[model samples]
Target: MEPLVRLHGITVRYDGRRNGGLVAITDVDLDIYQGEVVGIVGKSGSGKTTLLKVLAGLIRPVKGEVVFNNHKLNGNSFRVGVLFQSPLLLPWRTVIKNILLPIEVLGEDVSKYLSRALELIEKVGLKGFENSYPWELSGGMQQRVALCRALIHRPSLLLLDEPFSSLDAITREEMWMLLQDVISHEGCTTVLVTHDVREAVLLCDRVVVIGGKPGRVRAEVRVDFKRPRDLKLQYTKEFNDYVVMVRGLLGD
Candidate 1:
């Protein structure tokens, strides 16, 4: 099968005052398949986020090209839904309004996406709280709203950058299941950047490890766990084996 996105010899360098001599990542290559969850894990300063920015079209590499849908990705990035560590909801906007924020930014008809927003709200278990403000909801709930907001635009790809890292342990586990269910239902391809090796093993179909001063792909580990995996899988040796393997690749 053809890859949805492919990166060839991607290299990004910073030339500002503080980061003048830094090459964030060098010669990084990756392939993202349709409907597969790919996790990127690395140590601090390993350029995990830098690689993601390249995929997002936010950072143009100094060398090589990013191919999406068999076409070279230029300044115009393909539509992608991003869920960051912070929910970053607008203080004044209600839950439903927050979800529709992307549509508004794209200068689209808000009324046209009203139903879609509501549907996403319910899908994320925020149905009755749509009218409530972000301050009223818990951290997990706010992240749910953020997830809905990312999906409201119906983006071609979903990017997750340690989105659950801020939540409590129990809440993070709950969100893992919720995200898995939502991704299964939506059938959207995903790329996740996380520091947690366990998270990558549990949530991703394949894990890529980046290392070195100028980050590069060190190793790729494939997880063969079955769908709709729950927390119980964490106890099994198979799950831990995958986690251990990925950690080994990270050399941590």
Candidate 2:
């Protein structure tokens, strides 16, 4: 199948004045197909986040091109959705109102997306909290609201940057399951940037290991485990082997 998104020869450089001339990433190439999840794993400053920013069109690469469905994205033209480690919800807005912000920003019909907002709230386990403010919810619930906001627009591609990094272990695991369910049902292509090797192995169809100072793809591993995988699968030898392999690629 043709790739839904492609990054070809991507390179990024920052002004030396800002961070003393940091070369964030260079010559990185990747392809993501419809309904597939790709994990980009790297250490701090490995340019994993930079690569994602380039792909999402949040930042322009110093070199190379990003192609989405055969069309070259000029300065982030794709229908992209992003989730950061923090939920980043507006403090004043209610849960439903928070989700509707995108529609308002895009100048789309609020009424048209209203039902979607409500449905996604419920889908992410936030049904009754529509009128609740961000401050009232627990960390996990807040993140659920954030997920709903990202999906409210029904984007073609979703970018996640260590989104569960802030939560406690039990909550993180719950969020992982919730995210997998949402993506599987929505059929949205996703790119997850995470340092958690086990999380990568659990959630991704393929894991792309990034190495070097100016990060590039060091290895790519395909995971053929069955769909709707559970925690028990993590104990299997195949899963452990893949984790060890990825860890090795990361120079662990």
Candidate 3:
């Protein structure tokens, strides 16, 4: 199958005022297949988020190209949807209203997408709470609303940056399953940037380990385990081996 996204010789650098220098992520190349979940794992300042930003066209790479669906991505393209670490919901608006926010912003007919938004809210397990405000929902529920907002436009590519990082362990696992179900049903290409190795291994078809001062692809592990994978699979020796291998690669 042809890759939905391919990053070639990508490089990113950050210039902070106090410690201005080449801040990691150099010569990184990757390929993400359509309908596949690709997880990127690394420690803090490993440029994991930077790589996602580059792929999302939120920031331009100093070098190399990001090709999505066989075409080089331009900075202004709106073909992708992004869900940040935080829900960024409009506290003043209700959950359904927030989900419909994107359509309203695009100046499209919100009525056309209102049904779609409601469907996604239900899909993400936020069904009965549509009329509730963001403040009324728990952290996990808030993240569910965010996921619905990201998918309201039916974007071909979904960029998830630590979408469940803030949740508790049990809630995180629940959200992981929720996300897997969503991806499996929607068949959208996903690139997730997460710090949790276990989450990456459990949720993604392929795990890319990024490391070093100027970050690069240190390791790539394919999870051959069958789906629908659940919490039980995480305890198997094969899963443990992959976790250890990734941990060693991350130099943690």
Candidate 4:
């Protein structure tokens, strides 16, 4: 079967006209299959997030094509959902209203998606907090609201950029489990850009390592571990091996 999304020879450069410019990423190629969770791992400035933006159609590559479901992607024309490090929820909006923000922005019928919004809120364990404002919730709870917002439209692709990096270690682990469940339940193809190697190993079906001054794919490690992976898996020697391998690729 064809991949859900394909990036061919993607290259991104910043501020090229004045100076020679900085090359963010060069000749990066990738394919994301349906229902697969792919992680892009590297040190700071590895261009992981830039590659993600290219896929999301938020950044146009200097050279290369982004194809989604066979056709070349144009602008923000494809169905996609994005979550960032910060929950970035509107402070005044209630949880349910925040979750429904995308629907309203897309000019879709909010009434038609209300039921789905509620279902997602429940799925993310934010059921009773629907009426609560952002200020009333804890950081973790706020992130849960963000997750609900990302999934409300049932996007084909979910782009997560260090979504859990800001949380406490304990809360981040909890979110790992929560995100795993949500992705499995929603069956959305996801591309996650993170600095956390363990997070990549735990949540990704495959991890791609990008490295060097001009970031490029250094290695692609397939995670063959069974599903419903638990926190205990992180303690095992096998899991650490994967972590070590990715670290090695990053020149750590």
Q: TM-scores, in order shown?
A: 0.97, 0.97, 0.95, 0.98
Candidate 1 lDDT over 1-252, as tens digits, reads 889999999999988797566899999999999999999999989998888888888898999899999999976568899999999999999999889989989999999999988888888888899899999999999999999998998888999999999999999999999999899989999999999998888899999999998999999998999998888999999998888788888884
* lDDT comparing candidate 2 with the true structure: 0.91
With a 3 Å backbone cut-off (N, CA, C), the pairs that clash in candidate 1 are none
RMSD of each: 1.1, 1.1, 1.4, 1.0
111-136 per-residue lDDT for model 3 (tens digits): 99988888888788777898999999
Candidate lDDT scores, in order, read 0.91, 0.91, 0.88, 0.93
lDDT of 4 by residue, 1-252 (tens): 999999999999887777779999999999999999999999999898898889888898889999989989999878889999999999989999999999999999999999998899899888888899999999999999998898898898999999999999999999999999999999899999999999999999999999987999999999999999999999999999999888888895
Residue pairs of candidate 2 with colliding backbone atoms = 16-21
Over 4 Å off in model 2, which ranges? 18-20
Candidate 3's TM-score reads 0.95
lDDT score for residue 13 of model 2:
90
How many clashing residue pairs, candidate 4? 0
Looking at model 1, how many pairs of residues clash?
Answer: 0
Question: Model 1's lDDT to the true fold?
Answer: 0.91
Candidate 4 global CA lDDT score: 0.93
Candidate 1: where is the Cα deviation over 4 Å?
A: none
